[model samples]
Target: MTRSGRLSRDAITAFALLGLIALFAAMLNNRPQTTLSGGFNVIDGDSLSRSGDRFRLVGIDAPEYRQQCERDGVHWLCGQEARALLVKLLQGGSIECRGNDRDRYDRLLVTCRTNEDDINAEMVRRGMAVSFGSYRSEENAARAARAGMWAGNFERPQDFRREEQAGSPKGQDLFAAAADFVKRLAGWN
Candidate 1:
């Protein structure tokens, strides 16, 4: 292949790697989607221990692996539960993914799903994550409607981590937050 051809091939490879990163990042970004999508099983959260390159959930952000509870006042992590749920949902089914771009941490900004279910939305509705699309209006709407991590008294999942990094309370409430999300969506109490 000519030098130009080789350069093109390398660029394609780099792009592919970046896309992969966005997929992983979406799951961690706290911007889970509520629409059906799909892709390959990429990475299994350390908690799940599953084998596959999961088409990372997009549009929402779940708690980190080193978060803490506010009531008991100790160190803890809730991301594992969220990861387990994702693994269970995959069911080895096909996952559709919406690839954006890779973040600094090398995760995909993609929307993932299987059949007709949106894992991202499920995560938020289930109160396992929040809307990390703080600056993005479209994503913000999804987050607001889902009453994601930002719905209740608890802070956004991303912010929670920031607090931990700054030596503050790592608060979370999936149950109450889910209920609040339902309510925020103008759901009948």
Candidate 2:
């Protein structure tokens, strides 16, 4: 009824309601899929265990729990430290992982995220883990900042595993060898 009038008040209200409904629908569609529910136990720096199931974090590699690194002329337990950091991250938070590939060790390779953020990405961003797959930029940033292992001298986790495999007794895993060594030194069995 006014000069060059466009939308009526009732029409504007209807349009606003429609826009809100669309936004709600889009949010629902974008919600993440539920993966698992339970408290997680740390398997290593880059893996989690829950109810006997193992989930390896996708696109990142962390040090083995027994690996060592030299920083400022001092040897540090980088592997164990990484595991501790991951454990801290999982405290009071549930993780949901999404990925279907079973790794060579039969662990589920997944991209896990907590309510706060992506667990895998956070590890790399913290410089506690090295990115593999599509997250190289994150690793680069950590390296630039000299974060975690980047601040010291240490072999990559895969290279460490390869060396251990070579030195291990035929058909015996490194973990078993470590356990056997421990048992022998402890005079158990």
- Please name the candidate that would achieve the greatest TM-score relative to the true structure: 2
Candidate 2 lDDT over 1-189, as tens digits, reads 774454576678899999999999988777554467557889889988888888898999999999898899899999999999888877747766777667898888888777767888878877788877857888889889999888988898989888888889874677798888899899996
State the lDDT of candidate 1 residue by residue for 1-189, as single tens digits: 999999999999999999999988877777544333433342432112113322344566666654533323433345565566666776757765565554564555565557787666666666556555532554456456644333334455667656655553234355555677788799576
Question: For candidate 1, what is the total of clashing residue pairs?
Answer: 32
Per-candidate Cα RMSD to the true structure, in Å, reads: 16.5, 12.5
Q: Over the full model, what C-alpha lDDT does candidate 2 score relative to the true structure? A: 0.83
TM-score of each: 0.46, 0.73
Question: What's the residue-level lDDT of 41 in candidate 1?
Answer: 42
Q: Please give the TM-score that candidate 1 achieves against the real structure.
A: 0.46
Per-residue lDDT value at 27 in model 1: 74
At residue 10, candidate 2 shows an lDDT of 67
Q: Rate the local accuracy (lDDT) of all candidates.
A: 0.55, 0.83
Off by over 4 Å in 1: 1-56, 70-77, 134-153, 167-189
